[model samples]
Target: MNREPLVSVIVAVYNQERFIGRCLRSLLHQTLSSEKYEIIVIDDASTDRTSYALELFHDAIRPVANARNLGLAASVNRGIDVARGSYIVRVDSDDYVNANFLHMLSIFLEMNGYVDAVACDYLLVDDGENVIERVDCSERPIACGIMFRKEQLIDIGLYDESFRCHEDRDLRIRFDKKYRVYRLELPLYRYRRHDSNITNNAEAMRQHEANLIRKHGLDLAASNGMS
Candidate 1:
């Protein structure tokens, strides 16, 4: 009988042909045993060669392709829906991670059952993968490199489909209300910064920021003791 994997690594991709290969390769090279974790890649209707890039790893990953473009939040939610692991982690298709990324994070969670979720520090890199800065996940969190207990995520409700941007922030706000996300303090993830990054779109980010603020305004104010 096949035992279920301990961790499920979700990667959502859209028009990331140029970097998806490297991202998938990094995941395949993890120190964690292959049977211990499963990689789920959701291709969000990429019009580029991203499909071909994903095809190279056809046997190694569980691939899901959307018929139409559903954006990041929806794609991630879909991946979660199909995941069969006890724990979940998201890794953007354009970014990569160190060989120990999964082994370290999963081991921490395995030993610390009380923790609902755990995040690790990451190295920010340019398009060329040069180290720019080592970011503190607790102080400045990004969407990925965080591993959450699957049940905790489901109990809190998954990513909001309404959010085209700042989806991570929206989910984090809701998740933090009930459970705490502990930090690992190790730079195991690599975040790639490039012009095509969604955050670079000031207008979209501004709009989503407003939506997020409105959705959680009361909670935010109370946390800040303004209420």
Candidate 2:
């Protein structure tokens, strides 16, 4: 009998052929036993050799190839829809993590059941994997490097499909309303900063930021008691 995984790590990819292999290898080498976790890789209709790179790990990961490009939000949601784990986490195809990343986060969540989610500090890195600076998740929470109880995510309606960028902020708003995200303050995850980063798109980010502010402005303001 095959026991269900305790954690589901969703690796969302676009056209990251250069980094996908390393990302997958990092997850595969986690200190957490293979049987205790599952890795789901969703390719968002990449035009590069990303698909071929994924093919190399077909046996190690559960792969999903979208017929069309649906952006990050949709791809993440798709991964969640099919996830079969008690806890859920995400790792971008362009990024990787330390060996104990999953083990530590999952253990923390298991021991502290009162928390809705657990996040760790991450190191921002260049394309060559050189450390740029360590980001304190206590100050700003990025999308990755966090683990959430699957049920809690479902209750909050998961990631908003309407958002292409800053979806993490939007979800955080809704998530903070009912529960809290605890930061471990440990540099366990690596965040890649490259020239092709989607956030570099100034106009798209501006439009999405405005859209998020518009959609949840009233709620956010009301929560802060701004009248």
List per-candidate RMSD values in Å: 2.9, 3.1
Number of the top-ranking candidate, with TM-score as the measure: 1
| Candidate 2 C-alpha lDDT tens digits along 46-133 | 9999999999999999998899999898999899999999999999889999999999999999898798899999999998899999
Cα displacement (angstroms), candidate 2, residue 108, comes to 0.2
lDDT of each: 0.92, 0.89
- The estimated TM-scores of all candidates read 0.96, 0.95
Provide the clash count, candidate 1: 0
In candidate 1 the C-alpha lDDT for residue 222 amounts to 34
Query: By summed lDDT, which 10 consecutive residues of candidate 1 come out lowest?
Result: 218-227
- lDDT at 159 for candidate 1? 97
Poorest stretch of ten by lDDT in candidate 2: 218-227
Model 1, range 1-227, lDDT digits (tens) per residue? Answer: 79999999999999999999999999999999999999999999999999999999999999999999999999999999999999999999999999999999999999998888999999999999999999988888889999999999999899999999888888888888899999998999999999999989989987887787788995572352200
TM-score of 1: 0.96
Candidate 1: segments with Cα more than 4 A from true spot:
218-227
